[model samples]
Target chain A: MATTETVAGAAGEASQKGMPQLNFATWPNQIFWLVVALVIIYIVLTKIAMPRIAAVLAERKGTIGNDLAAAEELKSKAKAAEKAYNAALEQARADATKIIAATKAAIQKDLDVAMAAADVQISAKAAESEKRIAEIRAGAVAAVSEVARDTAGALVEALGGHADASAIEAAVSERLKG
Target chain B: MTVADQGLVIDPMHQFQIVPLFGGDTLTWYTPTNQTLWLGIAVAVISLLMIVGSSSKAVIPGRTQSISELLYTFIHNMVEEVTGHEGAKFFPYLMVLFTFIVTSNLLGLIPGAFAPTSHIAVTAVLALMVFLTVTLVGFYNKGIGFLGMFWVSSAPLALRPILALIEIISYFVRPLSHSIRLGGNIMAGHAVMKVFAGFAGVMGIASIVPIAAIAAIYGLELLVAVVQAYVFTILTCVYLRDAVGEAHH
Candidate 1:
């Protein structure tokens, strides 16, 4: 306690106030304190608080570096992802256009095929109708020739009995009625 | 209550009082009981750091445990600055020294805790150790002829003795200077803080000035604590150069 001084006590005191400048420390006592402080400080730093601080700082540094590296990786991945998305979009666009072209070709091909079939069927039906009309016309001409031949035969017979033109016309009319 | 009221005046500086362990040298150096207590506390704390750090020697550090490596690197870099390429070799010892001083200074700044460095004896011992080690290193590296450092090669032959003596005295004074710089600085800072605190107490309403001063001083003290540690380490580096450096080169 000789080494320790109370500032307030020493200052307030009248006679002893001047004694504050004096040092009463012994050599051995100073050495003892020296050794104790050194050894203790050495041991504590070597053992406890320093380790805590060291551990904390190292961890922080490592984590920060790791985070930075991870971020870099993520950025590359994102860029790659964007590129892939763009590529896929491009592929989709091309495929859509190609399909449209194919579809158009297919539709055009079908239309051409349908038109060819319809043309063939329509021509075939028209040819059959023309043949039918020619047969009916031939039959009508043959009927008129037959009627004229019969009328001439009746006129020649009527002339041998009375030679009357009126009788021939009446016979023809009667024949036509029967 | 005055001294008369309590029957005894309480010494505010009781914490710093030196109490003799025995009538004579107590285990080599004069030391008080409180100092012994502080030493034990310091040792315990430092030991705990070692245990925590060496717990797992993982390549990739995890948790707060990795701080051990950063401290290692910090001191390693400091040593390299002082010693160049050779500095890496002294990494462990340098790290140990830096961490110990830095932590001790920081611990002292804590309330009610004694800053061992504030005591001249403690700082003296550290400085002395540094001095002895650097000198031994010089001698070991350069042999007996390293004493030639005291004589500047360019000096005239007649002036050698005086120059040598001056150099020797300065050399002897290294530890004193090294110790005093740290101890004196810490003591004055603490004293100023105490004085400001007293002023604040005396003038309650206008105490903001002292409070502001205290705050500023506290910040400065923290900075000083770091700087002092660095200064001490740097000094060790400079001394080592003297120990191992070529005089002519």
Candidate 2:
């Protein structure tokens, strides 16, 4: 307690210590060291720190710019490839249409030739049948004339009066005509 | 222990005391004091963040690297925007200023730590450096025509002289306000925290209120620390416009 009281008394007595900031006694020391510290900081900054940071920043910017440019190039290349693909697809479609039209025309030509040959064969067979029919009619006329003559002669003989073949033939012929 | 045992003998200003680090009652200009130690700490912290943090030249940034880049770009854009294209040249110097001030300000926030930025000696040096650079650059770039910034041709003929006087006065006051603004804000916040801590020392169980106030004020001081640095940097850029950019009334 005595020691504490004495220390407090000493502090109270020297309470005139005033503002230490106004004490010009230490200003020189403070200024000296401050200038030294500043010079050191300035040297470190200008010589080392500032340049390194700037280089890093600039390098980053360059890398980013290069990456962006490369991306843009790839994008354009992809667009060109897509365009070529579409053009090829369109060309293939046109070729298919042309091939289909050519095939249809070829099929039509073959069908036309087959139908014309069939029509010629059918007309020739009809002509031959007509000729055969004509011949049969002629043969039938001859046979009928002969039968009439025979029957007429037979009748004459039965009636005790004979007749010639020419007369029978003439009469049969006249009746057939009628 | 002696001061603590006294309980209510709260000397808030005692925190700003710059005693010699080694055994001595005298402080020469070269004396390594607490101010020197903290200034060195600020420089080390800045070097750690900027130099070591950016050692990895990753195409993709990691945590510390990204933080370094964030500060770099923030100040970079600020300089470009405020001072136009030509101001880009001073980016490294401005980065130094910003990093130094902010680091000093924040390091001072530690319990029982000395704040170099809170001292007028340090902030005044920084502000004057900016002021000198701007003045020298203005004269170098524009010659005597740089004085046209004070002429204020945009004003009417009768008011031109009056506007010029005001411009000149405000122009000269830049360093004063710049230094004081940062030093004052930091000193005030830290001092206020100390005062509340003194209350906490005396008020027994009710010390919680003062403790809470200190906590809240510490948070404010943290904001103030970064904000004052930002203010200092941006003001540097704004003043730099007079040198590098075309004269605008």
Candidate 3:
């Protein structure tokens, strides 16, 4: 066992005496490979991978920006459309009011013309009725005079006295005048 | 009993040895090693994730695509937050650094797999590259005023020179600490797990203790893997912020 241990210890010492990592000879090789690896990685990243990733990111940003801009534009357009619609609605209301006023005035003008014609007809009918009333009053006066003259003649005859026609007519006319 | 007493010798450091793939007696610089194999695998996996997974470019992403996109956005936001909007231009580099380091660290966690980050060689190169880039960018952008970062304008005139010297030393030490921090943490975590695994081999049914410890340490190492990657990236951003002269100080 002691001999085996000694042999094992000797072997371990032999292996551990000079670590290859500490050897100055192989550094250039490792460094050269390192630079090669770094250069290759740099090329891959800068030329191929990074640009592709940047493109994707840029595309996403651009899409978002465009969507936001379009939304803003649409919102403004909708607002303008609403404004124009409101303005048109206001104009329509004003036009309707003006039309209503004009129509009312036209109707009022027609009403005034009709009222004037009716007034003329009513005045003419009133004048004709007034003339008839005057004629009726004249007839009533003449009939009353005739009735009194006849009544006076009858009364005188019955009383055994003669009544002169011209004298009785004159007496009825004078009494009617009184 | 000692590990050797039970006829079991546990060499925790054995896993770090670099062996030639084709059974060559001596490893040349151009020889394909385990490091090369795993590094290739990591690169391929990353490529598969970032490229082929999103090949369809569906607006609604699948799982792999979602992961890639999440990593992209996460690192992108980090750069933006730490380095500001101007840092956007450097985002690809930051993305590459983050994905590579994180993927390498995670792949290393697999049992019997090699962690490239466990070696100082790989991490030092990464750190040195960042340090050099930041220094160059600072000088390029700020010109002579880049030295103003080291000069302590806020300090008393007598203390300014001493403070400036300290700042200069700290600035130069940045790469050393940056490289070692990641490599050390990863190496230590793996080494400790291996040590515990070695103990489990000799303990028979009582191996439950080391097994439980291994389980717990593995969970911690997994957290460390992501956290170290984050720390490394954020520090890079901070350095970048200074380089771009965006620091309020």
Candidate 4:
């Protein structure tokens, strides 16, 4: 409530001024004082207090508007900062996936190379074992030939004693030649 | 001259008095007449209440505070609403003038009291204050150069002074007329009431009829009290029309 206290106060002041003048002042005297009071009060209200009050109100309005503008700016800045952070997080996730795929590929390549080397070693070992078995079989056949010659010589000697060794030997030699 | 031959010697308006501290030779302070003392007391009491009602007040008002503020606001709005926005500044003078008159008038109704407004001197001073305040407001807002409220500024220069002189005289008379109008009206109303009461007594049992009539008239006086306060305030606003600028009227 915009109270006119100054006016009320002015009246109180005038009343006090009024008291001394009651005995001393006539109608004219009172009128003169009343004029003086009115002029002074009007000047004070118009020049001093009223202007100051209006200025204060105007200043307050400007301050509130400034505050609103500042708040709006801050709100936008926060939104932009949030957007940047989300973009960075998304980029980090993409990088992590790429690294994981590369690791998987590397592990698979190592396993494939190891399996190929093992297959070659097994094939070479099998070929070497087949050659060694052929060599052992040849040695065994030579031993059997020597034993047969010796047995034949013994039989001819025995047959000489029994009178048919020379004729058996001649028939075996002819069959061998044919 | 003791002319109490038939009936009452008692004059309520007279016979009561308050002694004064200081002496004076001219318009001097002596024991004030009963009416003056009562009126002065009414003034002091009313002024004190207005002070109490408005000082260091709360935003949400209490009962006494609200009534005081309402009276203040009601007068303020009445001025503004009557005279439009330009009249806003005149609230100070109009408010003061209204409170002083209305308070004094209402006080006069208190059986043993008198209204200072019943005196030509007090009301004339009040009216004079309004007249001066408005004129000063007008002149201040419009410099000494803008005295065109009189005759047509468009009129030939030879005619301006004669017309302007008349306008100035009429303007000066505002206070005298305004004060008397109020003082006369209120004084008549009270005197008539007393006169009728005197009539009722003489008329005996027929006095009941006059008593009823007086009662109705008292009711009318109360209404007039409020109306006169309003009339005084409205005229202040209308007179203050030029307080801002000529366009304001």
Best by DockQ: 2
What is the C-alpha lDDT profile of model 3 across A7-86, one tens digit per residue?
Answer: 13332344557454575556766776777888888888888888887777677678889999999999999999999999
Question: Higher lDDT: candidate 1 or 3?
Answer: 3
Q: Put the candidates in DockQ order, highest first.
A: 2, 3, 1, 4
All candidates: CA RMSD (Å):
8.2, 6.2, 7.1, 13.5
Clashing pairs in 4: none
Query: Residue A68 of candidate 4: its Cα lDDT?
Result: 93
The total number of steric clashes, by the backbone 3 Å criterion, in model 1 comes to 36
* Best by the TM-score measure: 2
TM-score of chain B of each: 0.80, 0.96, 0.96, 0.77
Per-residue lDDT for B1-249 in model 4, tens only? 122756743232321112222433222222233344554565455545555554435444567556666666687678777767887866766756676668778877777566666656667777877888877877887777446676557668898888778877977787877877887777767766776777676777888887888788888888888788778778878777756646421
Better of 1 and 2 by TM-score: 2
User: How close is every model to the real structure, measured as TM-score?
Assistant: 0.61, 0.81, 0.72, 0.51
Per-residue lDDT of candidate 1, residues B1-249 (tens digit):
124552444333433443333333232233345555655565566565555665665546665345655566677677777766654555455666676677777877777776666777667778888898888888887888888898876888898888889999999999989988987776666666766766676566888988999999999999999899889888887777677656652
Instruction: Place model 4 in a CAPRI quality band.
Output: incorrect
What tens digits encode model 2's per-residue C-alpha lDDT throughout B175-235?
9999999999998898888888877878889999999999999998999999999999999
For candidate 3, the lDDT comes to 0.84
Report the Cα lDDT for residue B19, model 1: 38
Can you tell me which runs of candidate 4 are displaced by over 4 Å?
A: A1-178, B1-36, B55-60, B82-87, B152-170, B247-249
DockQ of all models, two decimals each = 0.12, 0.31, 0.18, 0.02
Per-residue lDDT over B32-121 for candidate 3, one digit per residue giving the tens place of the 0 to 100 score = 678888888888988889897557677777887788888888999999999888777888889998999999999999999999888899
Q: Give the residue spans of candidate 3 off by over 4 A.
A: A1-14, A68-178, B1-3
